[model samples]
Target: MRVLHGLEEIFAAKGSLLGTSDWVTVDQARIDAFAGATGDHQWIHVDPERAAAGPFGATIAHGYLTLSLLPMFMVAVYRVEGARMAVNYGLNKVRFVTPVRVGSRLRGSTELVDAQPLDGATAQLVFRTTVEIEGAERPACVAETVSRQYFGD
Candidate 1:
């Protein structure tokens, strides 16, 4: 994991591939819980039997659910120091390249795409994230996540 002492240091360094997270298996229970929490109980994501007969031959996870794992994956990559707080600014771009099937192992790779000064003691960082499914040719999710980190006074 690369450590950035300050925002200026981060901006000076060229983009580096942070690291990958341990594979997290996507199961039916997890999908169901995400569906319940988000009130997005779509048939393709929640109905196992029906989904088996449908498109992907099995129930798949919601793209948003996969997108939401960015923070968790980041934890496995690096830690930001000298910051009083960090906020999720927004996503610049997001794409669901492939479906994540039940019981599939998934992990993410992060690269520091951009680091720019936002305001006094704050910097905006854009991380290019790729969520990969084990044994799959295409990634499950691809996104550019933006974050704002504020330094302590």
Candidate 2:
């Protein structure tokens, strides 16, 4: 993980490559729990046996499930100390470039695309995050994530 000493350090990191996260497995248990949580339960996401005969030859993780792991993965990416809080502002663009199959390992590559001071002690940060599937040439998902980070007074 890359640790920035202060909010100013993060602000100065605009357009810099932040860091990548550790790999996470997208197993059936995770897919099933996600299905239960979101009530998606689609055959392609939760039905392994049926999906084996269908496209991809295996149960695939939901696109949103891949998207939902961003926050969890970011824990290993970077952090700015002395920041009072950080909140998800919004997402600018999101694309599921490749299907994430069950048992696949995924990791996030993050880059700071933009940053602007919101207040004397706050800044709006934009990160271009791409979720890369293990051993795949293409990324599973790509997104522009906006966030608000409040510095300590």
Q: Which candidate leads the pack in lDDT?
A: 2
For candidate 2, the per-residue lDDT at 16 reads 91
Worst 10-residue lDDT window for candidate 1 reads 5-14
For model 2, how does the per-residue alpha-carbon lDDT over 1-38 read when each residue is reduced to its tens digit?
A: 88877667886898898899989999999999999999
Where model 1 places Cα greater than 4 Å from the true spot, the runs are none
Spell out the clash pairs found in candidate 1: none
Candidate 2, RMSD to the unseen true structure: 1.0
User: How much lDDT does each candidate structure score?
Assistant: 0.90, 0.91
lDDT (Cα, tens digit) per residue for candidate 1, span 15-57: 8888899899999999999999999999999998999999899
TM-score of 1: 0.95
The alpha-carbon lDDT assigned to residue 24 of candidate 1 equals 96
Off by over 4 Å in 2: none
